[model samples]
Target: MTARFDVAVVGLGAMGSAALAFLAARGVKAIGFDAYFPAHALSSSHGDSRLIRLGYFEDPSYVPLLKRAYQNWRSLEARLRTDILTITGVLQIGAPDGKIVSGTRSSCELHGLAHEALDKAEMARRFPAFQLDDHEIGLLDPQGGYLRPEAAVMGYLKLAAEDGAVLHFGEKVTAVEPDDAGVTIVSDTGQYRVKKIVVATGSWIAELVPQLRRAAVPIRQVVAWYQPQDGFATQPQRMPCFLRDEGAEGSYFGFPAIGVDGVKIGRHAHFREPIDPNQPNPPVNEADLALLDGFIRKRVPGAAGLRVKATTCRYTMLPSEDFLLDHMPGEKNVVVASPCSGHGFKFTSVIGEILADLAIDGQTDLPIDAFSFARI
Candidate 1:
C-alpha cells in the first residue's frame, strides 16, 4: 500500500521519537517508523541510564545548547507526569590541567555555573568511594545527573501518539528514493511519500546517507555493573555520576547504583571496535570485563565488589567525536544526525525540537553551525 505524511521520521530511537513528537505537536502530519520497538535494546537509546551534564568538556560552545536541553527534559517530565531525569550530581576527576578537568572547569567558569573545584584530598574526604591519585582533581557539577533513556524515548513516542502522529514499529525502511518533489521511503511493509524526512537512523545512518559512510562509524561498546562493597557508599544519595580521565589510558564514566544494576562503569570509546549495523553485537568477553574491573579497582575501590553483569552496546562515532546535526548536503528536505560519541542521550529532548525545526522550517534558530556536515 502507498502512504503519505507531511514528514516521515525513520529510526525512532531517542532523536526520531522526539522529532515526531514535536512535528505532531505543532499540528504537522507526522509519522515515524522503527525497525524495532521504542527504546529497544538494539538501539543506542536504551542503556538503563545515560549521563546528563551541563559542564561539557568537549566544547565550551555546547554549554548553551545543554542549558536548553536541561529545560526541555524538565518540560518532558512535567508533560508525562513521570520522572525522566535523576539528578545525582556529577564529579569529573582528572589532572588539574587535563582535558576532562580543565575543559569542564572552563565551561563552568564561562557560563558562571555553580560548581566546586576539589583537590584529590577533598574528593577522597567527601566521597570516600573513589580512590583518587595524588595528582588528580575533581570538578563537581551540581547540574550533572543521569537520564532514564528508555523512559524518555517511550515518553516521547507516547506524546507523539497523543498528538496524532502515526507510529509504526518493527517495520524497517528498506530503501529511500529522493526526487524533485519530496522523498519516497520503501519499507518492508509498504511505501511512504513525504515532503521531508529526518534520518536519525543511529548506526544505520550510513546506509541511507552514503556521504556519512566514512564519517559516521558504528562501534561496539561494553559496560559492566558492579555491586558496591561499602554500604550505600556508591548509592545515588552519596555517590554521583562520574567521569574520570585516565590520561593516555582513556576517559571513563559511571553511574551510582540507582536500582539493582549496581554501579555501572564504561570507557568513553570502548576499544573503538567498529561493527556493521546489520550484524549482531559481538559478545562481551573477558577483555571487556578486565578493562572495567581494572578501572574500578584503581579508581573507585568501593565499587569494585562482585561483578553483577555486563552487556554490549553500539555507538556511532565520528572521527572528530562531535555530533552531526545539519541537513543532508544538497538535500533540502533531508536532515541527519548520528555518532553522539556516547554522549548524545542527554540532548535528545532539545535535538528533537531542532530536527523538527530543520525538517519543517528548513532552518533552526539554534546554534548548530558546529554540528554541520560541512565540518566533517
Candidate 2:
C-alpha cells in the first residue's frame, strides 16, 4: 500500500501541474496525484478562460511575479505547440481615483510598465461598450491578456507525463505527515512517501491543513457566457479585456468575444454559501444571472439581451486575498501553496517554477515574502 518517490505533489491542477512539469523537465523524480483529471469541471481550473494582466490592481508587489509568469506562460505555449495565451490588451475602468484605475496606475508607475490613461470621453470614444461615468477613467495595459485555463493545465500535465513524471488521477490525498524522513501522503488508493511534499489543493486546503484551514475560505463564483449580437464588430476586434469597479454594487470583469464559448463575463467578487468540494456545485440561480445581466446591460449593451449560458466555480480565499506560498511552519520537508483567491491561475506557471525551486533549493528568488503563511 505504500510507494516511494523523490517528490510527491498533491492536487495536480494549475499550480501542481506546473510544478510537476518543471520538476520532470529538470530530471527530478516527481509524481503527482489528483482527485479528478485536469480540466475537470469540479475544480477551479474548469473555466474556459482566465484573465492575465500585468498591471496588478491588488498591489505592486505582484508586478515582479507577473513578469515572470508572462515569460513562463510563453515558454509553456511554445513547448506545447499550442497557443495558451492571447495578447489582447486589458482595460481597468472605474472612477479616476477608484481602486481599479488608480491602483493599476500606481502599480504600473512603480514598476515602470507601459500603460495609457484615458478620460471618460476618450474611453467612450475608443470603447463604446463601456458606459463610464463622468468622473470615471480607463487605464490600458498592453501586456495584459487572457489565458486558456483548461488548455494550460492539460498542456503542463501532458508534458510532465511525457518527461517521466508519474501522474495518478482520481486519487485524493486524505492526510499528510512530514518529518526528518521526509513526507508521507495518504490517499484512497495508497500511500506515497517522498523526500518532499507539495500541497496545491486549491479549495480543499481547508481539509488538508487543519491549522491553516480557517484562514482559507471557500466561496462560490458565477460566470456567464452570452451570444454577442453582432459578434466582434460591436465589441471591436482588439477591444481590451475590462475590469470595472462599480463601487457599492461590486467589482466585475469580462473578456472580448473569442468565438469559443460566447462573450464571457463575471463579477470579480461575490458571497455564496459554502459547500463541500466533494458535492456537486449548487445550481446557478436567477439572482446570479441577473447580476451578470445587469452589468452587461449597462456596460456591454451589445451582449445585453442575448441568450446567456451560465456556470459556477469556487474561490479559495485567503483573508488578505493573496496567495499562500511557503513551507509549512515547523515542517521543512512540506511546502504549501493555496488560496489563490480567485486570481491565481494566471500566475500558476511561475508559481509552479517557484515551488519546484523551493523544493529543490529550499528557497526562491521570487518576491513571495508578502504571501507567506506568517501573514495569514
Candidate 3:
C-alpha cells in the first residue's frame, strides 16, 4: 500500500525528530519514518549525553548557529517540561596555540562571549581532576553544557506525535526518487509520496544520497564509560565537559559523570571505515581500549584505571568535517542533511529548525552556506 502527505521525513533520529516536531507544530501534515524508534541505541542519537557549547572550535561561523541552538533547546525544554539540557560548563584543553584552545578563543573573542583562559597550574587549581602537562592550557566556556541525547530525541518525537505527526518505526527506507510531482519513498513496510522530503539519515546518507557516497564516510566510534577513582570524586559536579587535543596525533573529548555515574570519552578523529549500519557493530579491540586508556591516564588521571564499559556508535563524516544541509543537487524539493562529522548532535535543535524552514519556505536565515553541498 502507499500513502501520501505534505512532507515525509526519512530517518527520524536527533535532527529529524526535531525537524518533524517543528513542522508538526506549524500544522503541516508531516510523517516520519525511522529504522528504529527515537530512543533506540542503534544510531548516533542514542548516547546518554552530548556536549552542547556555544564557542565552537570547529569554526567561528558556527557561533551564530549555536546561539540559535541554545535558544531552541531552551524553548523545547520549556515546552516539554523536561530537563533536556544541563548547563554544566565546558573546557577546551590543549597546547596554548593548538586548534582546541586557539580556535575556541578566537570564536569566543569574535562573538564577545564570556570565557576564561587558564594556564596549566590555573587549570589544575580550577578543574582538579585534569592532570594537564606543562605546556597545556584550558579555555572555559561557562555557558557550555551537555544535552540528554535520548531524552531530547524522545521529547521531540513525543511532541511531534502530539502535534499530529505520524511516525513509522522499523521502516528502513529502501529507495527515494524525485519526479515532476514530488518525491517517492520506498521502504520495507510500504511506500510514501510527499510534496517534499527531508533526508536526515546520519551514517546512512551514502545509501540514500548516492552523490555523496564518496564524500560521506561512515565510521565506527566507540564511547567508553568509566567510574572515577578517588582523585575524580569531584568530577561529576565540578569538572566541565572537555575537548582535549593530543597535539599532532589527534583529539578526544569527554563529559563529566552526569546521571550516568561515569566519565564518557571518545576520539574526534581516527580510524573510520565504512560499515553496514544493519550489521552488528565491530568489537572494541584491545588497541582501541589501550588508546582510550592511555588518554585517560595521561590527561584525565582521576578517570584512569577504572572499570570501562564501552559501546559502539557511528559517525557520518564529510570531507570538511562540517555538514551537508542543502537540496539534493538539482532537486529543490528534496533536502538532504547529513554527515554531521561527529559534532552535529549539539546543533540538532537549530539544524532541525533550519531544515523545517527550508522545507516550508525554501530558505533560512541560518548561516548554512558553510554546509552547502556546493562547497564540497
Candidate 4:
C-alpha cells in the first residue's frame, strides 16, 4: 500500500503527543495511535504532576537538553493558553556525598546554573515542615517545580489536532514493519503505512519492538498521597518539591499539596517487580504502604497520619537507567523512544522536537548521543 501520511506516531503519551504536535505544526501529514486515550492513567504521564528541574542529577550532559526542554515547555504553554508548569522551586536533598546531591552540584557548577547550596540547619529553618537529618544537605534549583503530566499530554494532543494531525485513541497498534520506502503499522482497528514511524510505547514497548525487550523492562511503581498534620504546612506557597537520597534505603521524592489536599510522594526505586503491560496493574497493598510509611514518618513531618490514596504506575527502565532515543537498527524509518527509566518525562518537550526532526530528515542537531542504541 502507498504511504498514507508522512509519519505515524505510536504511543500518544508525552513523546508521541508532543511529536505529532510539532510534526503537524510543520505541515507534515501525521497520524498518531494510542492504546488508550491520551492522559489516561493506563500508562506513564498520568498522575497530577511530574518533577521538572534545571540542575539535573542524572548527568551533566542532560543540562543542555534540559534548557531546551524548559523553553519548549514554556512555548507550548504560551501557544495553548493554559498553565503547564508551576514553579515551586526544588530541593534536591541527600547526604553531601550522595548521588543526587553530588550530581546536582556538579551539573550546577558545570553549567553555571542558578542554585543555592543549603546546609542541614538552613534547610530545616527555611523549610521547617521537612525534618532533615543533620548529615543531609540540600541543593535548591530556583527553576524547579512540577509539570502537569495529564494536562501536558492532553494539551499537546489538542494542539496536534488543531495543527491537522490525525489521532486514533483506544486503538492498540499490534505490529510495526519497516520497509525501504517507509513503515507499516497494524492496529486492532485497521492498518497504516507511513514514510516514518516513531515508537513511544511506554510499557508495551517490548511488545511492539521485541529487540528492546532486554534493554527495557517495565517495573511497577507506587505513588501515595498523604494528609498533613496540623502544624506543618503542605501548601505550595511554603513547600517546594523535594528529593531525598536515602542511601541503600532508596531515594524518595514528593510534591507539596497544591491542587490536592494531601501531599503526594513516590520512591525513585522501583518495586523490583516486573509485570506484563497487557495485564491490569496490581493493587496497592499493605506492603507498599509500609514501605512509604517508614519514610513519611521519618522524613516528612506532616505526612505521618493517613494515606489518602495509593496508585500504581509503570516505569519502563533501561538497565543503565538512561533513555533510548535512536533509530532501530537497520531500519531507516523506525525510532525507539521509550524506557526513560522514570526520569524522561521532564524532557518530553524537546524529545518531541527531536523525534520530528528524525522522522522527517533522518537526523537531528540535538546532542542525543547519550541516548543512542549503541549503549543498549
Candidate that beats the other on lDDT, 3 or 4, i.e. the better one: 4
Candidate 3 per-residue lDDT, tens place, 25-91, comes to: 8889999999877666668888788888888888889999999999999999999998998887889
Each prediction's Cα RMSD? Answer: 1.2, 1.6, 1.6, 1.2
Q: Please, what are the lDDT tens digits per residue for candidate 2 over residues 1-376? A: 2436778889888989999998888888999999888668778888778899998999998998999999999899899899999987899988878888899999999999999998888876787666777888888988887898888999999999999999999998999988887888889988778898888988788777876767887888899988876464345354678888888777887888776556788887565557677678888998898788888888877766474579988888888888989998888888898959899999999999989988878999888999888899
lDDT for 35 in candidate 1 is 93
lDDT of each: 0.89, 0.84, 0.85, 0.88
In candidate 4, where is summed lDDT lowest over 10 consecutive residues?
230-239
Residue 241, model 3, lDDT: 92
TM-scores, in order shown?
Answer: 0.98, 0.96, 0.96, 0.98
CA displacement after TM-score superposition, residue 22 of candidate 4 (Å):
1.0
Off by over 4 Å in 2: 1-3, 234-236
Residue-level lDDT of model 1, residues 1-376, one tens digit each, is: 2436889999999999999999999999999999989777668987799999998889989998999999999999999999999898999998989999999999899989988988878887788888888888888999999999999999999999999999989999988887768899999998888888999899999989899888888999999999888856897888989999888988999999888878999998899989988888999998999899998998889989899889889999998888989888888888887747778999899999999999889999998999988888
**Colliding pairs, model 4:** none
Best by lDDT: 1
- In candidate 3, stretches whose alpha carbon ends up further than 4 angstroms from where it belongs are 1-3, 231-233
Check candidate 3 and list the clashing pairs.
Answer: none
